[model samples]
Target: MTQTPRIDVVGGAYEEWCLRPAWHEVFGSAGRAASAIAAMAGPSKVTLHCYADARTAQVLEARCALEGTRLVAVAVPATCSFRYTHALQRPEVEVPQSTYASVVVRAETVLRFGMLEGDAVVHGKRVVYDPQGRLTPEPFGANGSSADELFIVLNEREALAITGLAEGATALKLAEATRALHKATGVIVKRGPLGALVLDGDDWTEVPAFETETVWKIGSGDVFAAHFALNWAAHGHSATDSAYRASLATAVYCDGRGFPEQSTLDVFPAMPIRASARWMAGRQPRIYLASPIFTLGQLWLVEQVRENLRMFGLEVFSPFHDVGYGSADDVVQLDLEGIHNSDLVYAVADGMDSGTIYEVGYARAQGKPVVVYCENESSEDLKMLEGSSCVLCKDYVSSIYRALWTAMAL
Candidate 1:
């Protein structure tokens, strides 16, 4: 008998869904996958889909590299079957039980460097174009309030996030229109208002939409896809249960912020319930990385800080710190929002950006901890943060540990 391939978790452009302040909670749906992949072995090959350009493509590459994983970017076919979506319009239970997802283990990379499934271990957790939020004057300072209170708020979005349905979807529109419908693992169809469905694998499970006053139904289906993929990858859950959980989570998320919810999954019994508990227990600290991008020094410094924060049981969010999104406006917006929400701010001073200096001042002004990673051996650059209390770490790891310890009053 062929040994079953143990999937760490499902990823790809799928994760970008969690980025929007509105849809992040739902699309950022599966924590288990992160945890599952984390617990695996060495570097692994992961295939990525749904990428926009070379920047994100390289980002995917860089992220995988940091995680001790290898990433292979593949074009996500424009036409995905409507079946791939969990329509999520129909009702499953008589009383609509709340849906939930279990956190799967994020073991260290299990697959060897050159040995991913089909020469790939894991793949895309990609995010397409999310043209929301702002272009800031002070890049990386958007969400820099403090790491202690790094929770996302619902920013009621205006645009809808929609993925193109499978090629034939525009044709038959019915999700089940598969060529060899019999050989495939069925489709997870996306339907507006009607909800989504999981057609194959096990029994068909109809997931209902969470009724809300209503806004835009843009990325609800993508949200459902995230949860379904998480459930499927983590638990090997039956199509029926996975679809149900994905549906409920999507509805709840869409109704509220349409973003990734930080709460541990709490709906159905995913295959690895303990995985959820472990991740929850880990409770990695949240780090809002703010810095000028493109320069190798800045990038390397940010990564080192992130690694240090992880050592201190913290989860970091520098989504914009990525060189791809590190455009001037992108960086500024990040500073604006990050300063508003972060428990502390870690500013890398390796590059030119008096604007970054402004953010440091902002963090200090707001009484949020500010840690500066100044590659230059000068105390002059640290002048901006003079009036406002802050820390100056010569190195990344020490600075991060110091910042966390300081945050904890240690």
Candidate 2:
């Protein structure tokens, strides 16, 4: 009888806190990845190597026990933590350097920060070495170790940092540059929403990210790398196929904020997964912000929406920011022009402001997609919006993500 394969995951474990979406979890890259791998590995055994304090170690040990994952926690002075007001905002707390000494790896198939001797995947972290210091992208395999077969997964910024390529480099160019620098067998550059670019040997494949009704962006990349490692390194799947599966797994993680079960994986291929329209057009979509901005409270909400949308890397045309306060005749035409130029309209429908209602109606008339955040509004007030094919959401985070997805689909 054949023994089950053992997969090793070596990375950081820390505290993650968010405000708007209200999330508090005790998993950084290693913990999340190990959980995902264990969930999908079936009969395979999984081990996680990470640095953590006593409190974190205890929490991780309990979680591993529940998930049947082996925990190898190295004692640390303090477990690093990050706080975010929203998923798109930068972490308020600093991420201290966790790796003081080299972590020894003995497993044949490992997911790690750097290269291992056998089949391995590497993911670099953007962290600060000192408190109150700026974050820097840590290079992968900085100690010069190489693997028999290695895969490197990185975001666009990390790819540019590692390859020393100029900004705005094409995915294929970044992949080629990384291969030239590291001699990696495979390279995957993750483009959020736009999907991923995978290069194996001389072939290139584009993998589309599965759409989710709501997005929890934190740790989604870790889930992707974990799934990819499990499929490509442990199961010997092709790079492109592994990446496609990884995308599906990431969508499950983002929507549910938990590891996916085998049943979801079984049904994912049959589900409708459409590529983003922005991806096909090779340009970012513009969003027209329609909201009341007269009072202090209204202005604050409008600013919050605008900031969050911009943080998602979208081009926002906010009337308050762009046109400023003016008479109806002065601003109405320009506002309508902005709506005409945008790909979608995101309106805050609280209090049923007349201007916001008119803007939503006009956007619908022009056949542009509209997402309305209608908290505290009565059903009667939202009946027309619900009837006119507008996506209505009551919560803040869901409303924002719904608008983003709607724009991308357009």
Each prediction's TM-score versus the true structure: 0.30, 0.86
Candidate 1 lDDT for residue 44: 47
Across 183-247, the per-residue lDDT of candidate 1 in tens digits comes to: 23444544333344445534454454443322234454435544554455434566567667666
Candidate 2: regions farther than 4 A off:
1-4, 96-99, 114-139, 269-284, 295-297, 307-314, 375-380, 395-398
User: Could you tell me the lDDT of residue 304 within candidate 1?
Assistant: 63
The TM-score measured for candidate 2 stands at: 0.86
> TM-score of model 1 relative to the true fold?
0.30
Poorest 10 consecutive residues by lDDT, candidate 1: 145-154
